[model samples]
Target chain A: MTKMTIPLGPQHPALKEPVNFSLVLEGEQITGSTVNLGYNHRGIEKAAESRTYLQDIYLLERVCGICSHSHTTCYLTCVEEIAKAEVPERAKAIRTIVAELERIHSHLLWLGIAGYEMGFETLFMYSWRDREQVLDCLELVSGNRVHYAMNTIGGVRRDITPEQKTEILRRVSILEERTKYYIKLGTEEATVLARTQNVGLLPHDVAMNLGTIGPTGRASGIKCDVRKHEPYLLYGKLDFKEITHDTNDVFGRLVVRVLELVESYKIIRQVLNYLPDGPIAVKVPAKIGPGEATNRYEAPRGEDIHYVKANGTDKPERVKVRAPTMANYVAVPYMLNSGYLADAPMTIAAIDPCMSCTDRAMVYDTKKNKVRIYGWDDLRKLGIEHYKKRGVDFSKL
Target chain B: MSEFEKEEKLKAQLEDKFGGAISDMIIQRKDRVWFEIKAEQLVELMNFMKTGMGFNRVSTITGVDEGEKLGAFYHLTDENGIVTVRAKTPRTDPHLPTITGVFPGAEPYERELADMFGIKIDGLKPGRRYPLPDDFPTDQYPLRKDWKVGDAYPEEKTSPATEAK
Candidate 1:
């Protein structure tokens, strides 16, 4: 039989971002593939040139809702490097706390997504329910659910109160226990194993050559992580193993993420112990001297790198962000070629795609006075009304 | 095994391989031997570092535009650390041979550099479109200094007919 090509998306239920996966299938097995992207382009780097250094903190934080802290941390680290600024011990500890909290939230969110992809609603519900605790803890510190604008150029914006500290530690211990239980279930559970084991296998050599990062890279036995090697924030000073799995399969990737959740919990507990007392932030000079710096951090997805060039101005001269999903997206065609049609959704979902993180945008509904909600009929009605108002021919837009 | 000795050894080894191609070897702060080389020598230098000096990992491929010139950086890190190889081409006639044949992993990166910087890859198949929109202008490059970001994306406005249609 001739191979038939199936197009998965620039918009599909299986993907969170706008990526088109063109798969050539021989019956149920994928034989070849091509991945396309460029939807939701926001020209974030160019827009960054127009904003001030302080303004860009909140701006960059919105890059990825899940990896929001990662973007801010990466951008702040680049700026700190350029300014030659040393974060205070207390500030560093607090930053570590927030970063760990972000990681916990991100991994849990990914877990829920993975569960949903596998058609395990029970697992999805439980995972999201557990994730709510971390979100609460984050809100206690950062005061936002999605985009926590806590990171600043020199340090952090919010300080954890003594009561908040106790609450955070208590919550961390609770999460640690729940995470341990879930990890046991994930590893030994029959269904998870059936779905994930030996699915989407990426051999070590292929992973290394592909330049994959994070758990995706780790799953394939490629010990490449920016946090472990480059050592950003308190990662160098902190003690935590660079989690890896030798299996190089879907199950292996799941195991790596599960193990990392526990490690993030351990890091958070350690950070709380070393918590110091000091101002949360410092006065950044209005005029920063011209300099360039590159900051790379291991985001929940993979290695997220940001290059910042400052020209002694409040606004940056230029900023380029390299999201990990973009790198991992390259390896998708290879992975799909090795998997069956039954494994397609799970394998595709394994690579967490966040187009908003690669770029940035914000929309306001001025006329509606609330967020705009588009439905098929509503859109059609709006289109009809527009033609009536314009009093022009219907063919041309 | 000492950091200084290792740095010196790598620097010397690199010098021996490509005479006078490496320059401004800084040993501190963002530690990496920064250098510029002819476009043709990049793939050869990358191969030497990967096979000879053990720089097996491609850390990142970044593109920069400097008015009449465009610079591309191939940052590779081994079990040891980072080795940065920077190469450039004239902005008007931006063309570079494909390195994907040697480092299969560099394909996405090369395509990205090509798409964003308007750098043409001589041997790359012409139809491989990754991130650019289907309707994006063929000649306009997003990362070039001259291609004003403001001009690249026109202000998004919903026309009445568009909404109606």
Candidate 2:
């Protein structure tokens, strides 16, 4: 029997990022996998060198959309470390609230995508419909649903108004009830369990070896959450458990994410009750001082690390960002090549891959690789050849 | 332990490791340590801390493009607060001894630093490009100071999430 490799994508409808996975299959089961990235390397760190510390906040927020708040919070934490600036109590509370709310929205969004991948269109629509509640609550406080621009130098850019707080709590209560139902349906439904439960079993040692982080790492028994470990902001003060599972399977990942929604709600409630009173932000001084710092925070997915060096100037000398998804991608091949081709889309979707936000193709006029064909013609030819080999209609191709 | 006491203990441990490598170890405002070390003795100093001291957790490995040369930062930590070991290698051929064999977490960090800064690490697999695309042009490092960022680079402008949203 001859074996063939199937290229999943540099472009696939199921994937949000341009991660090309060459699935070497023996029949319908995946035998081996090679992962490809850099379809979304936006030179974000390098761009920070040219921008001011204040400007980098808005810029870095654009690095990953789903985790934009996390990115901004992570960057600000590192800079705050270097500047020795203290974020006021109210700022910390507000930041923590936003962080938790973002976590809730992001996990729901992932659950929705996973549902969509498994052909559960109703679940997908339901999750998104519920996600809008959090979005509306976020917009009510931070002005924008997506890029809230809620972070500043020494503190947060905005505060949660009293009226807004009531709305947030009311909406969160609704979400909590809805989330409980979704988790019950997702985990207990026989079809959903059959599709996911034991499909992608990333064992503990292998997960650590691949350097998987966030919920993926937690799913595999690795207690490596920045919140639980090195608590920055109000995470240390909050009263919530580090929800972890040792299964390291697709179901384990799902459970961790769903439970995190509950934990996030609890943290949000704590922030509201213990609301602090103070200014939201303070003016940071600009200078060329010889100081640098590294800060890590728990993003919705996993650990987000930021390294900031300032020469006392308003601009950073160098800024380095390490996203959780970048670390978790290392374990993808390990997870995908363990039987079940049909479930590949959902298993990959579980990682929530976020690439460059504005990835544009730059076609240089000079290149060497036979006679290059452009655009749809190339795709059409490949499709025709594929269908012809499979004895399918060329017109369908 | 308090963050200040954590810094103090780390400072004493560093001074004991290399005797004179501790140029300045101050507890910064965040209660994190800012430890400065001489460039030449960094790799040996880090090895000593790993083998001798109890600084087992390797938080991150990063680089700063300092025009003519690059400054390497090995952010190491434990239950005590963070301690950053600062070192510099020439920009022309920035190379460091690989710490992956000792500290397993450092492998990905080293690879990322190598790909981004073009810094070579001795003893690791010579050609391991994990994240950079295969067709990505040679002689160009994406995270470097002078990588071409004109309209010609495909990933020069945006991220997928921005377009998706």
Candidate 3:
């Protein structure tokens, strides 16, 4: 069979963000793949250098709409350490609450995208519908749904009021019930099982060599979570298990995420129950240090790392951000190889990729060559039709 | 053993293995450590850290502009924490050996180093520019201390109507 290459996206509906993937196909199977990024590179790292520590909190929060709190908290962890400020207990608990809620929101959003990619639009609709509960809970506490701006250099910006706590618990319990149903549905649904099982296999060794992190690595049985390995903030005190699955396929990723939703709820309950009473922030000098520090955070997607170097000024000398998506991207080509071309979108989505956070791009110009362009809708429809032929239709649902 | 002690033991082992080459060693905290070494020794140190010390993951690589010199920090990780290996090269002739053979994940980061700070990676496979537009000026390194926003692209042309006005 002759090899044909197709371009996936730089602007396609299949991707939540702008990223391009060039896949080389031999008949129905993908022989090779290359990911191109930089469509969303806003140079936030360079911008952070020009802003003061306090100002950079808001700047870094814009790194990812889904993991806003993760970036801020990670950046501030380095900033606060260099300044040597002690955050209060209540602030830590509040931050932990927001983080867990963000995790629930991000994971649920991924579940919806997974369902949509697999042509199970019903799961997409239901998970997104349930995701609003957590979004509302975040808005209630932090006054905004995304990019909460709840974190500051020393600690958090807001305290959790008792009334708000009660309401949050109420919502969390509701989400818990909904998530349990999802776990049952994800596990037992024949359509989901057929679409996901034995697809996009990432072996355990490949996952580690590529430095894959978060639930993606966990699904491959790497057993490396920043929260468990190097606990920060209230994670050390909170009780939750690091979920792992050794299946090392798209099904394992789906199972890990749905199960992680339950763990997020558990963490939310623990944080609210143990909410302490104290000031939410502390004062630090305008000039931070001639020192540097690196911080690692377990974002909803994976491990988010940040490095900050202060030059005895209000502004930082250097700021570096390593979004989780960037770490997991190296494994995309490896997983895409030897897999059916129809499974590419699901495999990419399984990483919960956030391109804006990674802010990288690539370009491939095959001008004088034969190539096919597949729009987002075309690829999605192709996936649905491909699965329908296998007797796993969700069209009626 | 405690995290702090574990880090200390690792530090001792590293010092024993590559004594004079490593310098400015500091235990930043319990779970983090920092040290500096020559840019030429990066590949050897990274190989030992990966195959010998079990620091199987390269968390991220950071490139910094320090006025007269260009510096890079390879944040290598294992279950314990991050052990940062810092190296510097002259800005006029900045070159660092790539550690992609030891940790394949470092490829993107090394490319990033080449693009942002103009620090050339000795053995990086030639590829398209990353996290930057293809038309981005070759001479302009955005993260360098002297780079300015206006340096990336040419000034926009004035319309004939505007010029007349």
Candidate 4:
């Protein structure tokens, strides 16, 4: 019996984000594992204090590319409550539409990444290719794909036009069909089931104690979806079920996410149909009086919290953000326990860990705007090319 | 019982139970209650909330840097609603009891708070820095009001004391 320790990421092909895990292995079995992450820290919370309530909305929106609306909405909800402002009915509907669309795109992206990690290249391509449709719908609705910037203090920034609503429904219905096929593959595919079934187990009780939320919590049978439990915005009016799977394993999580894709599609349709007619936003005064509020929303990953204390200044007195990854961090070691080292990447991906959301950055090349869709393979090629242009052979190095 | 009444009743019960440690109890809003507790009694209140009062899940542990004092809020969630237990300590030496014993989920939030706000917890396992660079300076807590963003840079002396020196 030999003891060994291996480190995964800050930089690794297996993980998309910057997170380091030191694994202590006895043979193929992982005896102990600890995760270390800080590589993505942008000091956004600290930065928020220096910005006005208006600027903080955009700053907080960039917290996670996948769950941008969740951040802004949580911030807006808190600030709005503090000011005692009522969000217009139309604004709430639009917010819910964007949020559900973000969920759809996020889950599809996670599915592709999960497939890529599993060495199933075809599944990766199929999921991301479908993910583009959701991104397009988002762009059509909010004018930007990643940072929606649609949440204002009193209401939302944008309204859903008739043409936009028609286009969104058409695209989302197509997505629903594609999602059904993925659901079949996710549940019945031998490779996926073999790799995921009963692997990386975090039982229902453990999940509750660790306070895991969203799909991960539901997969473990801990019913803690903030939307279902709290029902903020138009989520109360929307007709959709919170998907739950009691397997408490990687397979269950995969099932839960795929099911959520279908559910999010339904929610988008519901919000679009019930898209109330009213002003999208109202002018909020600069100074919000002394008040405090805790706003929680169900992000694509899990529950996201934004606590705002306004002391009558334009800037929030104190704003604290608790992203889902922070809440789910404690249960990672428990999931990694007794798990195989080979299955490690899939196990980590099952949690759909978002290091950027927890710690945080991204770089956009304006030159490559034509190709809105790209995959890990394309990214790897781009990296090689990016270095090769500097007269360095990346492969040789 | 109505949701609002259940929350008020819960607040009354808590105030009655630990009247000595509590200073003020503010019903912040519907389904939300904020209590100002002594820094020394945060853990005791957290334990009582989780065990006795059935506030089983730890929602969040937020750290706020007030100029002269540091405020920490512990948000606990249950069927009733959310109860936020707050405690403040001096900014010079912010130290309080840790509630990881009651809510294991709060460990990460507490760690981040400890690192970001220069706060000290009496007990939280391992006590290593999280979501921060390993080589990050010990004296400079990023979230503090007085800490500038580029303070670590060579020529970033903004404070008047630095100019005076």
Candidate 5:
């Protein structure tokens, strides 16, 4: 039998971002695989070195369009530690609310994407429709949906008002009701079961060995949630359960995320109920005293870690971010390899990969004795030419 | 029995194992701990931390280029607590032994360190350029203090992480 390679993405319709995987397939069962990431490397860390900490916060938020709040919260928390600035009680509570809202929206988005992978377009549409409610609540509180510049240096930028609080809960209640229906479909639906159950299995050992984070690790019964582990932000004060499952497969991941949505609802409600009266932010000094700090946040995907070192200057000496996607990709081969070819999309989407947060690619131009950088336009042109060479009229495209 | 005591137990275990190799033990926060050591002792220390203390998860492997010295910080954690080991390597010919053999999970981070700080992870496997364009200038390390947006070689105005957004 001849072993053939099936390459998926640096650009694929199924993948949300730019990631390339070469799966060596022998009669539809992947015998071996290799991943080529960095197609979306924006040089965030290197760029962070240039920007002031204030501007870097916004830049970091752009790292992942889905979980922007997670990046900002983690970044602010680390810088706050170094500055020794105390975020007011009210600010902490607001941060938790926004963070949980982002979690809900992000999870729903993942659910929708996973649904698409399973060819369940209805589930995809319904999950995304519910996701909008969470985003609406987020907008009500933070004034923006995706890159909510809700977090600042010392604390949060805006406080949730009483009217906004009531409205948020009103929307969240409806979102929760919709989530229950989705969870039922996720578990009991026949097609979903066939596609997801007993697929992309990651035993406890494999998860730990690969250092899978967030719900992926929890699905394998690892108990590695940073929210519980470190107790950053209001996570220490908030009352919630760390959702986990023992299924150890794609089904397990779905269960963990769907159930976590319920927990996020409870957490957001608690943060609002116990909302304290205080300033949202304190005056952080222009120059932070020389210090180093590490902050971790439980982003919707998993643990997002940021390391910051200040040289008593406006700009940080160095900033390193290890997004959960980086830790989770090692499991891709384990999940995708040796499976029926049809399961590849669900297995890959199960990790909820954010390639924008994970990649950096540089092309070597040996012929020109220089490197050639290809931007989006260049790639588009190449795609059009390939289709034209395939005897298609791209002018119509 | 107590939280700090449990952290102390892990620290004492590491201190017993590494001793003078870790120049100083600095407890940054409640759950966060830092250990400063030389670059040569890093891989062995990382292996010891995993095998000896059962600290299996590495939060991240960070490469920092201080104006004078280049550094690698290994933030390791598990169910017990978090431990960060900071080791400094020389600026010229910057190199640190890869801990992938120990942690296996440290490979991506080590690769990023190689690409960004230009810190050679002695035994890192060959892979695609990380978090940077492959055609990115070879010699100019991006994160170094001296390596500004257009400092070393002004081949083109843009940078690796510019699209890194």
Candidate 6:
């Protein structure tokens, strides 16, 4: 059989953001694959050099809609260290609370996407519906759902009030119950098991060699979580286990995430229970340092690392962000090879990819040398016709 | 052993192995260490760290513009902490040997170093420029100290709507 090459996306129905995968297929099996990025590079790192430490908090929070708190917390950890500011215990607890809540919502969102990819729409709808509880809990604590903006250079920005704490616990119980149901559904569901069991196999050695991190690595039994290894914020004091699975497949990733949701709830409860009474934030000089610092954080997806260098000015000299997805991306081509083309989307989604977070610079001109311009209708027609060749007809719809 | 003492022991091991090659060594904190070494010694030092000292992961590579020189910091991590190895190359002729042989994950980062700071990796496999457009001007390095936004697209002018107003 002759091998064929197909481009998965700079834009595709499966991807939520822009990234392209060129898969060389021999019949239904993918023999080789290459990932092309940079469709969504916004140059946030370049823009960060022009912003002050305080201003960059909000800016960095926009790095990923899902892991906003992770970026800010990681960036501020470096900034605060360079400035040598001591954050209060209460602030640390609050920050950890928000971080874990962010984890809950992010993991639940991934579960929904995973379900959607495997043609399990019922799981997608139910998990996403349950995800709203955590989002609401985040809003109650931080005044916003997505970005949270709860972190400051020295510490967190807001304290969790008593009423808010009680309400959070109430919601936590509900989420815990829902997550328990998901754990059962995820492991026992025949469709999920059939689609994910032997798919996208990333072995233990390959995971560590490729520097894969977070749940993706955890699923492969790498046993490397920044929270457990280094323990920033209140994680050192929190009671939770670093969940891992030995299956090393998409099923392992799903189980790891579902189990991690339980751990997030546990951490959130501990943070709120041990909430200390003190000022939420402390003041530091605007001019931070002539020094450099690096911080690693365990975002919902994996390890998010940030490096900040200050030049004795209010603005930083350099800011480098390594979002978790970027670290996990190297493993994508490795996993995609020898897998069925139909399993590609699920395998990619298993990494919980956030392309905007991964991308940091430059925008490609899709129109530069090409003379043809496909208008909206033309593009729609093209999409329909393209899918028609693959046996999916959308003309009537 | 305590975290700081474990780091100190690792520091001693590194100094013993590659004495004169490493410099500016400092224990930044309990779980972090920093040191500077010549670009020439980077590959060997990284190998020793990975095989001998058990620094199994290259966390991320950071490129910095230091006026006269370009600096690349490889932040290597293990279960204990992070050891940052800073290597400097001349601004006029910036080149660093690739450590991808030791850490395959360093490929994207090395490409990023090339894309942002124009530091060439001596053995990087020729591939499409990363996180940058294919048509991006070859001479323009965005993260360099002297690069301006206009350098990439020099002919750009104010928007027509603003001009009309």
Residue pairs with colliding backbones in model 1 are: A53-A314, A383-B163, A383-B164, A384-B164
- Please list the residue runs of candidate 5 whose C-alpha ends up more than 4 Å from where it truly belongs after superposition: A355-397, B1-3, B151-165
List model 3 lDDT by residue over A92-139, tens digit each. 888889999999999999999999999999999999899889888988
DockQ of 4: 0.42
Each model's DockQ? 0.26, 0.23, 0.43, 0.42, 0.36, 0.40
lDDT of 2 by residue, A1-397 (tens): 4677998887888676777888988778888887766677766777787777877888999988878899999898878877778789899899899888889989998888878887888888999899989988888888777788899888888778889999999999999999899889877987778777887788997776555778888888878777877888888888998888987788888889999999899999999999988898887776434577778888988888788878876778788888887778767888888566787888887777653222123345555534453444466776788888999868652
Clashes of 1: 4
Point out the higher-scoring one by lDDT: 3 or 4.
Answer: 3
Binned by DockQ into CAPRI classes (incorrect, acceptable, medium, high), candidate 5 is acceptable
RMSD of 2: 9.9
Q: Candidate 4 on B79-129: residue-level lDDT in tens?
A: 436788888999878898778888888887788888888898888788458
User: Model 1, A1-397: lDDT tens per residue?
Assistant: 8889999887777777677889999999899998777776666776677777877877788777788888888888888877888777777788788888888888887788788888787888988899889988988898776787888878887888889989999998888888988898899988888888888888988888777777898999988777788777787888889888898888888888889998898889888887877877776785675887666788888888787778887777778787788778778888899589878878977876653221223346898777655543476676778887888545344
lDDT score of residue A205 within candidate 6: 92
Q: Pick the lDDT winner.
A: 6
Residue A135 lDDT, candidate 4, scale 0-100: 85
Task: Give the DockQ-based CAPRI class for model 3.
Answer: acceptable
Pick out the ten consecutive residues of candidate 3 chain A with the lowest summed lDDT.
A355-364
Tens digit of lDDT per residue, candidate 5, span B5-83? 7667767887787788876787665777887977778878877877777888887988877767888888888864668
User: What 10-residue stretch in candidate 1 chain A is worst by lDDT?
Assistant: A354-363
Tens digit of per-residue lDDT, candidate 6, span A1-397: 9999999998899877688999999999999999887777888888788878888998899989889999999999999889999989888888888888989989999999999999999999999899889888987888677778898788887778899999999999999998889989999989999999989999999988889999999999998888998999888877899899999999999999999988888888888888988898898898889888999999999999999999998999999999999989899999999999999999999999863222122345677944564544677898899999999999999
If candidate 3 were superposed on the true structure by all CA atoms, what would the RMSD be? Answer: 9.9
* Candidate 4 lDDT over residue span A96-186, tens digit each: 8888898888899889888887778899999989988988898888777778778888887777889999999999989999998999999
| Residues B43-128, model 6: lDDT tens digits | 99999988898888998999999999999999999875888999999999999999999999888899989999999899988887
CAPRI category for model 2: incorrect
Q: What are the iRMS values of all candidates? A: 6.7, 5.6, 7.0, 5.2, 3.8, 4.9
Provide the lowest-lDDT 10-residue window in model 5 chain A. A353-362
